[model samples]
Target: MEKPKILVTGATGSTGAPSVEMLLQRGHPVRALVHKEDVRSTRLKNLGAEIIVGDMQNMDDVRAAWKGVKRGYFCYPLNPDLLDVTVIFAQAAKEAGAEFIVNMSQKQVAATAKSPATIRHFLSEEVFRWSGIPTTHLRPTFFSEWFLYIAHQIKAGKLQMPFPEDARHAPVAGEDLARTIASILAEPGPHINRAYQLFGPELLSYAEIGEVFSQTLNKDIIYEQNSVQSMADSMGLGGSDHFKDHLANVISDDLFGTPDMNDVIEKITGKGPMTLAEFIDKNRTAFTT
Candidate 1:
């Protein structure tokens, strides 16, 4: 039997990079679709992955990249216009006859639409399903690596959030997300037409996160509750008041409220997902000044 050729879109991003690595390690011929011919693609090329340079928004570019690819792992970078890009790519994938598409989706699809990320992911899943391709939607919860966005604040010894200090989230590790993607691609028959909600081993609050950081870095850390405006300003996220208001609404309602899906991870990958403490410990260097 011949190894399947899997084309991974967004191959330079966190999840895509690891997914590519996992596929190659499992002896699959992997092709990485990157936007620009840059150092990221160079790195993947060094890792023995065939690199195709193109942007998802360009249909001609996407079609060229999809040529002869049997499977796909798709992820959109953080963007408000993701829906438009996804629709284009989904159509291209269908026309190219890709057998399976594993999407990197958000947990927000389960609830209100604050950002277009969740809605776009849902739409892409629908596109794959309607196209008659076997699809696996990997809806992972809040990522523990999101703390990297605010790592400087932790290094400054302050943790500020829009929600309460005790805002709970089931933050999954990105590597676990990659592992699940690899599992689905490696053995597509089992996950055909199914969506797997992936989560970490436990639910943790911001307060608990702070505690973990403090213990890991051996420094005093404090979690402060900031108003939506203040939080947005602190994060330097410039937008209309409506965006801020929607963010506040989602945060208040706790969009991270989801049950543990570690069982699914174990069932699919035959391994337990990484824990929050392990994630913090592994990435503790980012929190140090």
Candidate 2:
């Protein structure tokens, strides 16, 4: 059987780029929608994916990218335009007669949440579901890549926390989530209209995560509980007031987040996801400052 050509949005980002590569590696045709024809797109083009340069918020560009694509993966970044983008993308997918599309969502997203962004996320999920498209929603936990946000702090041998001492979570890697997205696109039959909660292999608090860093990097590490604003500023997540509101609510949401492990990646991709230590070691330079 000929595999359907797949479309991946945000193709230059953390998850979407990798999803494109893995889909191509799995012997499926891939179309990558990037914002520009830059070095990253060039690399993906070198890897044999048809590259389309366009903005996801533009209806015509999305329509053009979806042309002849049967399956798709949609991921937007941390901005205020998610709902608007979702509306455009969903309509484009419907017009394209898409067979299946996977959406990237964060865990603990609820309509009742205080974050407008969280509400937007919930609405975005419904946009696809209401579009009558065969869609799968993946609600993943925090990404281990978030550590890079505070690389300076980590390089100084400290893991900063913005939550209560009791709060814990299993930080997932975006690459692992991308693999799961590829698995679903590679075979979309079983996942139609399904929502999966994705996480890592183990749960740990900020202190424990610091311990892992100390062990893996062989340095004396410490964790300091910080105020949300301080933490957000330190990680550069406090640039805008609207985004800070979302960040604040998300921090509140994480305080009560489910702390457990799941095998979603292993089940879908036939391989377990990497731990924080292993991820740090692999991207050691990023953490080394």
Candidate 3:
């Protein structure tokens, strides 16, 4: 029997790249949906994926990508039109009769959250479920990739984040999350209609993250307590109203909430989640630069 080709949306992204690599490694034919033909798309082509250029927002592009694909990974940028993009994807996937879809969502998503992004994510999950498509949702907490937000500070030997020292969340590694996604794509029967909250091995605050950096880099990395305003200023978003509202959400509700930890990753992938130290070690060059 000829196997169906898997379509990977966000093929050039942090998670999508790894997922594409994994599927190709497993000898599965893959159609990579990329927004543009760039170096990243070229790399995926080199890795034996069929690259299709299309925007997620454009229904025609999405339909073209979804054609003749039974399994797919659904991921979109964190933009104001995220929900609309998901709708386009869901409608297209339904039209294509896709067998399985893995949706990339957030662990911090709440029904009552004030952030438009969070609210959109929360509703996006519901839309996929209601679409009656066999779907699995991956709700990952703060990605270890977020360390890049302070990569400048780390390179300067100082760590600065808006969240309080006591505020903590278990940040998952992007590669680990990708592995989980790939595992499900490889065998969708076990994960159908399931939502998994993916997290790393430990819950860490900004202060603890500083300790990890100091130990991993063998440098005196200091965690400086900065107000939200100062943090915004540091990040060159001092006057942005959008960032101010997001910062307010973090301060008032989001950052303080603890995420539920689980062994879902290990259970599915047959490997334990990576640690903060491991994440830093893997991307040591980024922090050092």
Candidate 4:
């Protein structure tokens, strides 16, 4: 029997890359849609993936990429114009007779007003459902790997934050999320028409994360809370007043929520999610320089 053709958008991103790798390892025929023909595109092409060059915002490009594809992994970064692009992808996917769509979505989407990212993904979900394509929304919690973004502060011996040190979050590893996505894409029907809340095993506070960083780096680190106004001043609102306001509201409420999903990771991917300490230990070198 011939394997189904899978198309992965945002194929160079953290989660998308692993998803592509997993699908390939599982012996599936894959095509990667990238915005530009670059070094990354060349590399994926070498990995037995058909590389298609196209911007997600361009319907013509998206339509071309969807040709002969059966399943699609739609994972794009947060952008203000994402909704417009998503609509085009959905329309194109439907016209091309794609069977399933797996979206990389946020867990806190239910609490806040539609940020550009959430709005676009929410619309994509609706489109897929109405178009009769089996859709699975993977709402993974905060990524433990995102700590690398703040590694500079850890190396400087402090974990500065806008919220209290007790602020808690369930942070999952991107690789784990990718594993779950690949499993579902490999066998489409069971996960179709469902939204899975993916999360790590434990709830950890900012102070706890700091401790993990300290242990992994063999140094002392401490979490420091900053006022909302102070955090806004430091992190700039980025010209989106609505996004800024929504962010402030969510952070004030303590954006790090508890884990609600049970062991869906083990059930879906046949493996436990990676722990924070495991992630820290594996990527400790990133904090060194």
> For residues 1-289, could you state the per-residue lDDT of candidate 2 as single tens digits?
8878999998988898899999999999999999999999999999999999898889999999999988899999877899999999999999999889999987877777777777788899999989999999998877888887888888988777676555678888889999999999998888999988889887887778888889988898887888778877887776676667776787666524664667878988999999888888988898885
TM-scores, in order shown?
A: 0.91, 0.95, 0.93, 0.89
Cα lDDT tens digits, model 4, 1-289, are: 8889899999987787788889999999889998888887788888888888888988899999899998999887656666677688889999998888997777765533345455455666676677787789887766887676667667788777665687777788888988998999999888888998888877888888888878878889888886545444444545655445545555433346544446998899889998888988888777777
Q: How close is candidate 3 to the true structure, as a TM-score?
A: 0.93
lDDT of 1 by residue, 1-289 (tens): 8898999998988788889999999999999999888888898899999999887889898888888987999898656667777777777888888888888876656444555455555676676667777788887777777777788888999888777777777778888888989989999998888877778887777788778777777889878887777766666765555446646656533365645445788778889888877886788788774
Q: What is the RMSD, in Å, between candidate 2 and the native fold over all Cα?
A: 1.5
Residue 178 lDDT in model 4?
86
Decoy 4 TM-score against native: 0.89
The window of 10 residues in a row where model 1 has the poorest summed lDDT is 110-119
For each of the candidates, the C-alpha root-mean-square deviation to the true structure, in angstroms, is: 2.2, 1.5, 1.9, 2.6
Between prediction 2 and prediction 4, which has the larger TM-score? 2
Per-candidate local distance difference test: 0.79, 0.86, 0.86, 0.78
Candidate whose TM-score is highest: 2
In model 3, the worst 10-residue window by lDDT is 251-260
Which residue runs does candidate 4 get wrong by more than 4 Å?
Answer: 111-116, 227-246, 249-255, 258-261
What lDDT score goes with residue 191 in model 2? 90
* Winner by lDDT between candidate 3 and candidate 1: 3
